[model samples]
Target: MDLPRDAQHDAVIVGGGHNGLVAAAYLARAGRSVLLLERLPATGGAAVSTRAFTGVDARLSRYSYLVSLLPRKIVDDLGLRFAVRRRGISSYTPHRDTGLLVDARDTARTREQFARLTGSERDFEAWQRFYAMTAHVARRVFPTLTEPLPTRAELERKVADPAAWEALFERPLGETVEAAFADDTVRGVVLTDALIGTFTHAHDPSLRQNRCFLYHVIGGGTGDWDVPIGGMGAFTDALADAARSAGARIVTGAEVTSIATDGRVAEVAYEDAATGRTHTVAARDVLVNASPHALAGLLGAPRPPRPEGAQLKVNMLLRRLPRLRDRAVDPADAFAGTFHVAEGYRQLQTAYEQAAAGRVPDAPPSEIYCHSLTDPSILSPELAATGAHTLTLFGLHAPARLFAADPEGTKRELLAATLAQLDAVLDEPLADCLATDADGRPCLEAKSPLDLEREVGLPGGHIFHRDLSWPYAQAPDAADAADEAGGPGTDVTQATGRWGVGTGCGNVFLCGAGAVRGGGVSGVPGHNAARAVLEKAR
Candidate 1:
């Protein structure tokens, strides 16, 4: 919907992702005239829910799934109408007839399962202690995500546990995992969080994995990644509704072309994607909810090094949950939470090494989780009664370059390889249980990073926009500090402050995942960006 641009808005937000929607809501709630423009026909960029399988009523969270980053404050402040439930089964990793399973409600069963797999009670004890430390760190650090960032020294003091800080921040995550568990499967399970959308050796001296590891562990005050009730789209829907109710003007199918700031106000030029009619509107300030690269293009700034995404997303509607070869547990138990397939520690390293060298691995280390198992709201009554379920798979180490050479062929080969790996653990072939779509085609679709870039505006298909930045305020090293101290081009991150969302341009700011402490579906970036704008307006 296009609104009359006769009057100027206090702020204009580009893009309609959850972050963009969030920034608009908060800015408007503060009594500012906010106008948000989105390129897509509808809001909710990647956090979308769609009826993936035609002829089926199943609405799968197409891109992003689960909930952990969104804080309770945003939910309560917006009065958003949505619910998230905890998965009963934490995770299941099958190895032949027996597998390692973590039950959220049953510790005794979990311990027994662990003991059976490792043949030792020590590993389970270590597992409990290790997570307990992470839980404490999560409670301490998660609150700061939406607030002003503290310096590294202050955050470490606040954490107060030198060992915990060093283990997570200073050392390689693989070292911590290896030290904590004897079994490779358990170690791999722990390390998976560090490499969600990132591709790097766990021991990379750059600590790229460290930042990724921290974000995953410090979400939702419990570090427990939970399932969204309806789908990821529910969160975006609620966010959009909140923004609209707050008096924010949200214009969809409005693709912004350029932004001109005269160190005072910004003029936003956009084209109506449907009609091809271009419009330019002025705003007192502009909040860019697009990627840093996307914003750079709009401002005609020098582009940074391209970031690459590393994951293969496969959405499937199953006729029935495939039977687990392990007879001790039912399919429901295996498919509930993160169901690890061939994701052992050594196995993960092997895949990473191969993918890093531009070759797809023979066996990919990925995981599957069934949304219907936890919340059946995503599926229709008929589908539910017919034992239909929605399965989302995340394959690691399938970087953008791997598909660059052979997009379709590589995608097909990787998908086949990953499913074949999955078949190795299950009693029956995964393809056999796939439901048919409206056209009678199998209900399964795979996406590579190349595909993600074309569909969604993720440059290089990076999920977090770029590599996740450290949450603290201090400079990592002397070289980075020198860069911030005017050794070269402008350092936008310097103005990003402990909580500031400035993009180095006084009138322009980053309101997307590229912003400090900006990642996930949390809405922290949006909330913090609004806070920055409100503070400046005052």
Candidate 2:
């Protein structure tokens, strides 16, 4: 089914995610006829911050929380009003009597903390060297993510540090971490960043962990993962406002079912989610911000390898901060930033091995950070005065296949194990300090990969859409441009590697996480797709 030719839009975007909204705003600002459709009753996709508890006033970043990779250029170019606040304390990993606290701004304190944790000043110096290397790589590679993919050799040459490249870009992250840091605890602290949402082992031969580590460290070149000022909702809402102000039309609950590009004007057919009525629209180009698997399924093509999400997310609002057993550290400081729990290198390896065999890790490695601790804007005045705060825990190594056998049972078991692990490090039982909403229920909910897939449109619940790819393209001998890597889209005049946003169909472009350089809430895919469109029109 095709809409009337007269109704053709200059561009149509499917999926009203942050990426799609960004595309709409840019295209509309550029004076193109733009329209965006979202299946949900509202936009924002997984980037939204909502009050998940039935009666809590705390607005938590439900799924995709934190701002690490969002390019400042996108925010400045779009004139987005969203503000991201940097955390003072970077991270804390508590073990027996003491903990490893990383202070972002206080270098002297950070050194002192490391010296005590490692019981030697040598590890602290090594820590400085490792971060210096990452800082250098972050500076060089962050800018290139938004640009056209450079050849691997080109990027390596630009990075220039062979040791940095080998540790981050080439070798398994585990081997690199082991070689750089001598202390076991320090090694774990450094390695945690490499395995955030990724489910691979540190020594996985696939180098999947290396790609994941690059993205986490290369945040807008500064490598600072800032917290959104008001919740994630405020940030996405600003994007929506910018799009509307630029004259782009956005329709919620308009589920796009099919996209066909066989004819002159590409056709987008959708059923009104609100009214269950079918309709077709015409577009000169369609920017799909949905998952790649979703796009393939929509096009009736053979699906890509099923993407598997490998983390369990639990969002909880606590009445007060949990007590820490470590007397040297204050509870406030410990929870203020990323609080790493059970994330040691050996612990992570054991969990991965367990989960890989189709069993949920007995003691899951996870990290928790209190968003309200950093930005009180997430809570109302009453809630804040009452000492209520929001805690979001991300449990690692809980892969999709583990939940595939028994999703409900597995989620409960995993959440139980995850929290128990957290409780072990705390001075008191975690549940004892939990908050209750107006409904008299605990202000906590856990989402497994299956839950994310069902609710947030993440295919197979994979957050990065799938395993992340390197920022640069392979050499000529490596790129399979003709077929598997990337094919001609129905309307795309020029087809390039998978790194290019161009779909095999000429008129369709993937502006989702599946697009290379697209991970987290970074708007690189949207920005790149728009630039590609504008370039082609010229």
Candidate 3:
């Protein structure tokens, strides 16, 4: 079948992932003729679920891995029905003699428990003050993620206000934690939030930004942490359904081969892989959900420059539940929320160093989640009866640029080593219940973070479109400071400003993790992109 070529729409969104779908939905809702094209047969990109095991459907990125910094108002405004269940995230660190679990719900009780276990009242108090301060800053600044970058006047105001500036952008998370806690265990627990889904070390100055990053997960006022009821895919499915209902046309298995520009605007050339047919669609605008590097390749151009970090991912399927040493934990607790295997702050720093050197750590710092423990509906009847589960292990970082050297073999070894590490940690004999060969690891898939640079067409797979550094956010003279700081390159503020959905680059705008607020599954970039387009149409 030859691909159908419709008349030019108001926008042609490439990559029908969550963000693309979101941008399309907003455009369609605003009465624009919008079309969404995806290379894969299904939408959602990373935020998807697939039937991997026989009779089992599991989220691709399990647990939506704790909500990204998406805005709540957009959810209500779009009438999106991706049901998110709220629960406080818990962190646990177990040693030979002691273990500690930090619960966001009963902070007072949790604090008491911490104080008892670590014998550090000062640490507990510090944690309280830090959380309160960080949460306050997050409340004020995170909302700006959905809007365009701050104007010069607003930026100046924030920079001039000492209290406002420190609360929002200046306080270093590590320094803050060190000042608050004398116990290593308590300090480790507080720092875990900074490392979740990221490769940053606990001691790095960049970790301060992570403090604000945690606030994004708190859901504005919806409380901290939410699990989409049916799994993360439901969130994407709801957005897709909402987009279609709102009159956006979505075509999957339609790989965008190139974005050819006629010097004035861009037209996307795509190949429908299933039919071996090619087609072209003209648009005044385009939104790419792929990583910046991937997008640059499709455009047949030198990728725009990027920052120096990479994004990598790993997924796992387990035949049995993780046997944790913390006997007090309810068996149900394993699946109810995320589990952090952070031994201490130094341990995390070592892992980051190893990754930087292009080596996997022997005892990796990991954040593990067992979806079967949380959502039983996806498990097979037999698996559920036997308490089998699917576990996702994130936080294995390597030089982002290393994937090109030995992608498959390296990933295979990393996955095998990770499982071995898991075996070492578990009290039970996990090796006995192995369902798949060690050589053919199913869940452990790897992708270079630098690849995001290509896919999203951003500078260094440094998504978030720009780096939300303190200097960028708090500079009194944003335009002048950004200009001086960047010299001739794009910095954070300019990146955030260009993220308006339909307003930037002659209809080509941005949405997704690489936009203004960067990566995570929050859907904020998508939502913001949509609003930008809709506002323009109005």
Candidate 4:
């Protein structure tokens, strides 16, 4: 059906990020008229690629750099022509003069390396057993992401392993890691997943780290973060294509200011950035693909506490891979996978303590990877042939609050400190390996939490939008659902039912990171929201 200019759409999706595009495509394919409005001149949000430095030929996955949480079901359902290349090595963490290298392709080598680092095979044996448990949980739980919300009891039964569930879900991740690993570096490597973008201690009673760890380990039922071939934009670009082909109208530079709903129908008011003219469109349902804070502002509801992000994102075009202090490892092999820096278990706890005290860590912990090593397609032929590479570093314990007073100054100070940590494990200074732009400036750029908020509209630069949620339904006897609504994106009401994406108003649903099981680059929330609309219609 050709929708008239003034026709009420079946769905009006605010924020044409990946999730919005996914929802629009699904709905439109189901013969529902869909209109997607985006504030930015472009879509993709954080999952986008761009040349950070002027005259640079390499396109970097500037923000969210890997493809882990994105489901293959979404890719196949949408027929997105995208691919991810796995690195041969999983990770490498350098200790004094030596390091621990986990090889994805060769477990025997990884075991040997572990034994060499820790002076015994006990930690390696424990590592294998611990991840085996997570793998079992991942296999059981990952499939539930695209399905309707399952009750906690139902999910628990599905997991089957009591030990795995208790270690991952009940106990603090710190206790679990401490019990499982003897080496500080190995323990830190395992715990890094729990603290990425989350500003929390390992032993925090809140179990926020546990939630973060679950999402990281459960992606695609394997938890391997593969490099998106042709950069991160490839996924969203394909999503946009699929949405348009399915007859969804995508309006870029349209700022959706407010959503007015009365349970049954909704009016979306947006201002076109180009014309500076306001337009209100009626829709049977609305899908929000923005942060919880943005959603509250749109619905004219009380804003929740701002979620603080805790990482400094740095993107760089390197002339060549930096040499490592450990001569046993090749730079190519080291950069091919995640290179751990200043992230020993004790170091991580100390950094968290310092950051919590409103100071940058003396030595910032970080995970660095050279995406070009696995997928050189992100670089131009010239750059790729010249051995030029892309380095993406995610610095931890640098919370948004640390940069609130002076974002620029703190960003510079933090970058200096973070790079200093990286250099400690390297043979030479990282600055010397940076490629120069046309204007002769180093091709390195760092984004503090404030920068993410300003540029990507991420509230407080919380990349997962807010704290990640458990992927199950609350118990029937649980406290008022509205009170238990962990994020502003979720607002339970009498009309809301099994779907976790539902809002207080019946006609609105969240299809963004704030939605349950909706963080990362995964389009699960969008898929679930569309499914909810379909189920309601049925």
lDDT of 3: 0.59
Identify the runs in model 3 with alpha carbons over 4 angstroms from their true place. Answer: 1-6, 55-64, 152-164, 202-218, 221-223, 262-265, 298-301, 306-314, 317-320, 380-382, 401-404, 433-504
Report the lDDT tens digits of candidate 1 across residue range 1-538: 5555666889999999999998998888889998999998899999999998777899999999988888998889888898789888989999878899899899999999998889988889998999899999999999988787677898898888999999998998878888888898888888888888899977889898889988998888888888898999999999999999999998999999998876477899999988899898999889888888888788776777778998999999999999888888888998998999988989989999999888999899898999998899999898899988999999999999998878999999999999999999989998899999989999998989888888888878888888888877654353233322432255543335436466666677788888878778889889888887787777
lDDT of 3 by residue, 242-285 (tens): 89999988888888888765423578888988878888888766
Q: Which TM-score value belongs to model 3?
A: 0.82
When 3 and 4 are scored with lDDT, the better candidate is 4
Return the lDDT, model 1, position 14: 95
Query: Residue 518, candidate 4: how far off, in angstroms?
Result: 1.4
Supply candidate 2's per-residue lDDT for 339.
Answer: 92
Clash-forming residue pairs, model 1:
70-522, 149-498
C-alpha RMSD between model 3 and the true structure = 4.8
What are the per-residue Cα lDDT tens digits for candidate 4 across 1-538?
2224466999999988888889999999999999999889998888899988998899999999998888899899988899988889899999989999899999999989998899999999999999999999999999999987788889999999999989998999999999998888899999999999899988989899999999999999998888899999998999999999999999898988998877677898888888888888999999999887888888888788888999999999989988888999998888888999999999999999999999999999999999999998989998899989999999999999999788899999999999998888899999999999999999999999888999988999999888888888754333225423434444432123466777666778888888888788888988988998888677
Q: Output the lDDT of residue 498, model 1.
A: 34
Write one digit per residue (lDDT tens) for candidate 2, span 1-538. 2245458798989998899988899999999999899999999999898888887788999998899998889999999999999999899999887889999989899989988887778888988888899999999989887787888899999899998998888889989888888887788878877787788888999999889888998897978889999988887899999999999999888888988775235888888876788888888888899888888777666667778888999999999998898888998999888898888778888899999998988789998899988899899898899998899999888888988878999899999999998988899999899998788988899999889999988877899887887887644333324323333333232224534677656567888888867788898888888886776567
Stretches of candidate 1 above 4 Å error? Answer: 1-6, 475-495
**Which of 1 and 2 is ahead in lDDT?**
1
Each model's lDDT comes to 0.86, 0.84, 0.59, 0.88
